[model samples]
Target: MRRRAGVGAIQKHRLEQEKYKEKGTEIQENQFQQMSKQLEVFRENLEDFASKHKSEIRAENALNHMVREGLAWVDSQEPKETLYWFPSMFAECVSA
Candidate 1:
């Protein structure tokens, strides 16, 4: 009878540990889902801001002018970065 009681206690302890592990995994999954949603929202907001201020953003950055000029010469290749350009050259050429 004593041996049977000891075995039962061990089984109960194991079951409790498994339940705790399952609960922890569920909590982690929920947190990951919430973070993923927030990241998507941030991406959408950034895209919207870029569209609304497209001219200002392009005018403010000199690199955009260079990229725009480079893109015009390329016929087959696609640029890896976003392209922004003003109608005329905004940066002066500096010979080094």
Candidate 2:
């Protein structure tokens, strides 16, 4: 009788654990879906912003001026650890 009770308790615990694990998986899937929706909206906004700025980006003289200014700022930077992550993240954004 005692051995049977122990087996019953173990079975109950496994059933509870399985139920909770399923709930957790459902919650994670919901969160993932929500995040995907948000990212889709963000991508749409980015596309709109880029389209609105297309001509400004292609204006050669102004583009050259901006590039020169950017280079000058880069030349004056005190080197630190930040350059590593920012560029890689930018690369990821570009690829994505």
Candidate 3:
């Protein structure tokens, strides 16, 4: 009788262990799914940001090129009046 009871206890312990393992696996799977969703959201946000800023970056580059060309032209001109006019104009352009 004692031996039978011992066998039953051992079986119960094994069943409990299996249940615990199953619960742990389920929890890990849920966490992985949540993390995967979060990662996808981050990826989409990054793409959106890049798309939005791309045009702004191009506009800024074009403006910088124009400014450089203007400076080069000013430098090539005679320094007397061009020098006086360019500084104030450049300052206004920069401040604007």
Candidate 4:
């Protein structure tokens, strides 16, 4: 019957719509999980960077303090006469 054909078409259209909706939801969930994992990795990397820099800053501070104490001419006008004027000397100090 023509009426049964129309009803069958409508049912098929509704099922197709439902299938597309479910597929869209699944894709969105997959994308959300991927983003969450990326965010976690980014946070971990940021924390590692912060931790390394914190220790490095502390070490540099201690080295600078030592250098300032060892060479009294660092703050003087004739600082060039001291090792403070040389970039190589500071590099050596930090490396040591």
Report the alpha-carbon TM-score of model 1 versus the true structure: 0.55
Positional deviation of 71 in candidate 1, in angstroms?
22
lDDT of 1 at 7: 81
- Candidate 3 global CA lDDT score: 0.76
Give one digit per residue, the lDDT tens place, for model 3 in 1-96.
Answer: 344558888999999999999999999999999999999999999999989899988866765666676642334376565321245457888999
Task: Give the alpha carbon lDDT tens digit for every residue of 7-52 in model 2.
Answer: 8889999999999999999999999999999999999999998899
Better of 3 and 4 by TM-score: 4
| lDDT, model 2 | 0.71
* TM-score, one value per model: 0.55, 0.56, 0.51, 0.52
Q: Give the poorly placed runs of model 3, Cα more than 4 Å off.
A: 1-5, 55-96
Residue runs of model 4 more than 4 Å from their true location after superposition = 1-5, 55-96
Best-fitting candidate, scored by TM-score: 2
Collision count of model 4: 0
Per-residue lDDT of candidate 4, residues 1-96 (tens digit): 344558888999999999999999999999999999999999999999989799888866766876777642244666565334445558788999
Q: Rank by TM-score, descending?
A: 2, 1, 4, 3
- Stretches of candidate 2 off by over 4 Å are 1-5, 59-96
